[model samples]
Target: MTQFHAYQNRNPASRERYPYLLDIQSDLLGELRTTVVVPLCPADLAENMRLSHLNPSLEIDGRRYVAMTQELAGIERKRLGKTVHDLGSYREQIIASIDFLMSGI
Candidate 1:
């Protein structure tokens, strides 16, 4: 049986096409969170998240789920258009969003 089958066998209708790789980051204080999501397999998902020094959340099918925080995960859901050449500036916006969400804005 395939690794995917172990997690997805219960639902044969599931497809790998829409699988998402999510990465989450937070300060040591756990007061800040940032996230990025890409399309990739579970192994690569863990690798990339590790490279970014963040923990990961795993899910199988739409019924079962794992997450650090919905709002933190929601950051990647809102795309920022084309990639920004200036990551410093872009990073500011991301940090601001995290702060806003955490502050209950």
Candidate 2:
């Protein structure tokens, strides 16, 4: 379900069309974890990074600390992008897949 594979499944149109779906998928996954009583999944965490283009910073005793290097952010972004694109029927069956992930947590 890489972006290339997603592209192969749909019309050869601009990314604007599919990026929204990606956003929607990402947002829903995020909201579910933050608002629900259920546990978060690795996939949900991955999608959060993809949609937000940001990864978690450490927060020990309520003090936040992010990597000072920009290259770290770039590396995380690339990793998340590849992960989101690698899933099966990502948009169509996101919730079910997410539920499975939640159950595993």
Per-residue alpha-carbon lDDT of model 1 for 1-105, expressed as tens digits?
101111111122322422332233432423333334322234432443332212223334423222222223223322323221222323443344445546745
- lDDT of residue 21 for candidate 2: 17
The candidate that wins on TM-score is 1
Question: For residues 16-44, could you state the per-residue lDDT of candidate 2 as single tens digits?
Answer: 22221122223334423221111112332
Whole-structure CA lDDT of model 2: 0.25
Reference-based TM-score, model 1? 0.24
* Deviating ranges (above 4 Å) for candidate 2: 1-75, 79-90
Poorest stretch of ten by lDDT in candidate 2: 67-76
The numbered model that scores best in lDDT is 1
Candidate 1, overall lDDT? 0.30
Q: Report the Cα lDDT for residue 42, model 2.
A: 33
